[model samples]
Target: MWAELKKGAAVAVWFMFLTLPIMVVKVNPIEQTVVWRWANLVWLGAAVFVLTVVGRYCSRHRTELSAFWPDAHPLLAHPQLKRFLLIVLALLATLFPLFFSSYQINIMTTALMYAVLGLGLNIVVGLAGLLDLGYVAFYAVGAYSYALLNYHFGLGFWAALPIGGLLAAIFGVLLGFPVLRLRGDYLAIVTLGFGEIIRLILENWNDFSFGPSGIAGIPRPGLFGLTLSVDDAIMYIYYLVLLLGLITIFVVNRLRDSRIGRAWIALREDEIACQAMGIDKTKTKLTAFALGASWAGMVGVLFAAKTTFVNPASFTFLESAIILSIVVLGGMGSTVGVVIGALVFILLPEYLRAFADYRMLLFGAIMVGVMVFRPQGIIGNPRRRSYPLPMAAADQEVGHE
Candidate 1:
């Protein structure tokens, strides 16, 4: 016990020292003053100490505690309970805007957009085992598609929606062709470079992408050509995103159960084995890329319509990381888990504005904890099917044969 306490204290002290500059010292350049937030240091140290102790305890007894984990809870395993919870959640979502303020609705709309993006990336990374760090390029394609089309041709949201997705799908195919033979870290680096290249082109091409100032004042979605008030518009976008999220969930779920989806999973597990089984590797990979990119593009259109603006800065590597994190933090290949992960990741940060300065720190810590304790994610993917056999009968049949 004393050894554990000592270790925890050491960790707490190290963290406190590491965070000293950010959490303890505040310097005002204009006023030429430096203030010491010693209280923050104390709080940080205490919190870290407690967390360290708890983490150590959990690690030591992980096997014993496995049965008590959220995913393993007997109540959560009940089919009827699952249905009841899902129905209740649906009802709450439908009535959300009615009770919540527009600000909250807007936040939820953004979260839904990300949820869709996560689901799209799940198709590639989770199902097909493709590490696409340049996923945001497709998102940028979608947003910019809508923005540029509206700017140049007076195209509206509805028309640009499909166009954006189609354009992104083409881009996905283009990207897919080049990276067909790449895998692992090589694939990640190439995708990262691809994303940066897209951003650079947008930033440097002044004539084409408005030179980083970005095109603004893009109109929101219209309802029969009627203009809505700001609050009404927020609510409208929320519902639109809600509907889109539902559609994405349904499509992804179907894809998960399809032959192609199984092929993708097989490819993810063992590419050579998948080929041995007569699966067309090239076609399967390209399909995953194209489908994933299409969803990002569509959500990109939604993002632009909601924000009423588009710029190169908004679609960065950080955005890709966040989307990818959603997939990791939620169970990869689990649609419901991805949605829950998105809401927790996006909404918790918004509500915890008081800890704005420590946001990234907290995020990193939580990710580390999850990786260590729940590598399968907050809601790991459950086995969808099982084959049962009667061993005695099988043995008798074999004996008779």
Candidate 2:
């Protein structure tokens, strides 16, 4: 205990010194003045010390804790209780917009959009085991598809939605073909490069993409050609995103239980074993990429419609990192976890505007803590299927034994 306390104190002191220039000292370059906020240093040291000690304790007792709890929640294991909780959550979601302001609804709508993106990426990174750092390139494809179609041909949001997804899927397939043999770091680098290439094209090609100025005054999604007021539009979009999120959940759940999904998982576990087991690696990879990209593309179209604008800057590498973080921070293969992760990540930052300067610092700290303590993620374990042998087969095996 003494050694642990001493180590924690050392870590805290180290962190305080490392962050002194930024957290404790503020410089006014214009006036050539320096302001020292010593209190921040104290708070930082205290926080780091507590977190280090707590983290070490948890690490040491993790096995014992796991043995005691066994399940994440005992009540959650009961079907009836699970059903009731789901119903209650559904009610709350349905009534959310009625109780909150448009700003809140808008923020939730963005969260739902990210939830869809996380689920889509989950297909590739979580299921297929592909490390795609350029996932945002497909997102940009979808956004640009709608913006350009609408700009050049007066195409509406409804018409461009599917088209954007299709275009993004094509881009996904194109990307998949080149990296078919690549794996691990090589694949990540290629995907990252692909993303940068798309962004650079959009940035430099003014005649094609309107350059950095972007396309604006894009129309919002319509409801059977009926016009809506600003508030009504916000509410409408919220509902639309809610519906889309539901559909995505259903589809991803089904896919996770399907043959293709199993194949993807097998591939993720071992490519050689997957191929040896008669799974076609090429087709499996292409489908994973295509399907994942399609979802991103569709969400991109919605993003364009919701904001009424599209630009290259909006689909940067940071966006890809955020989406990837959502998948990782949530249980990668768990649909419900991804949705929860998106809500926490998107909404928490919005509410923490007052601590904007410390937001990234806090985010990094939380990520490190989670990685060290619960690498499996918030909802780590996904459901697995069991196959039971027939009585005759069991008897035959027993007799042979």
Candidate 3:
């Protein structure tokens, strides 16, 4: 009883530390805002105390609670039902723009964009076990490549999309080369520096990038003889991104089953052992980086086209962090997991817009809670096999005996 009480008290204190700023005190001096709403702190603290106690109970019973998903996995093996569910889901997605509010559709569009980014980043971090903080640099490279080519050279969105991807892939290879010998924190720091460097260059190079002022009036995408307009643009972009996201899913799923994918998984599991198995480390890593960046680059063009603007601010480290978080939270290397993570990360915040000021705090709290409860992730990688041999190999001992 005493231990539970102590734990509850501690949780209450922690929750107060996290939510206090948003719960009390308006600190925006620019609008001459200085108000203290301190009374609610007590109520909030008490509520947190009760919730924390209940959370402790849930944590202790997590295995029991989590059994439902394990149970459902067998049901998923029914092929016809699985296909039927998938078709239904796809049909729902196809009809989303027709039924949902424009605002929700816009949110889904953003989610799809992140899903693509997350899938790309998963190639490096999940499959290859790389820690790249400059992933957004490729995103920026793609966005800026399209923006500049379209702005200065009069290239259309369709024409510039592949070109942007190629440019980003080149940058990815360049990044991969310098960090070839690095790993873990060192690699992460280098990538972080690279991302910052890219942002700084975009911000400082006034003439080329137009500096902080940004490039505006970017042309929107269109079908032949149909220029996308404000009324239907979100829906069009939704379908566009949805198509891109599906292709990404298919490609990534295929790659995960391919020889290259096997090499990547081996590298991720044990680099030295993978090297001993004759996988070229440099080439493999570079390919992972290049492929991931290409996805981001392709989507970056759509991002630029969607917003009709490209600015250095849009490609900050925060963007990379968010994308990486989606990958991590979703279960790295799992395409469906990344998609779920993106939708959860993006849509949850939007749903909590009523508590706009506390959005980040809530996010932090939720992430902490998730990590504490599910260290692997919301959808972690599957358990590995106990033995890496065929049944024949296991049975060979009998013959020898």
Question: Which one is best on TM-score?
Answer: 2
137-242, model 2: which lDDT tens digit per residue? 9999988888889989999989999999899999999999999999778999999999999999999999999999999988889999999998999999898888
Which segments of candidate 2 are over 4 A away from where they belong?
20-39, 67-72, 384-401
Question: Which candidate order results from sorting by lDDT in descending order?
Answer: 1, 2, 3
C-alpha TM-scores of all predictions: 0.88, 0.89, 0.87
- The deviation in Å at residue 121 for candidate 3 is 0.9
Using lDDT as the measure, name the better of candidate 1 and candidate 3: 1
Return the clash pairs for model 2, or none. none
Model 1 spans with C-alpha error above 4 angstroms? 10-48, 70-72, 384-401
lDDT, candidate 2, at 38: 97
For model 1, how many clashes? 0
What candidate 3 gets wrong by more than 4 Å, as runs, is 10-37, 69-72, 383-401
Candidate 1, residue 213: lDDT: 94
* Candidate 2 positional error at 319, Å: 1.1
Full-model lDDT for every candidate: 0.90, 0.88, 0.87
Worst 10 residues of 2 by lDDT: 380-389
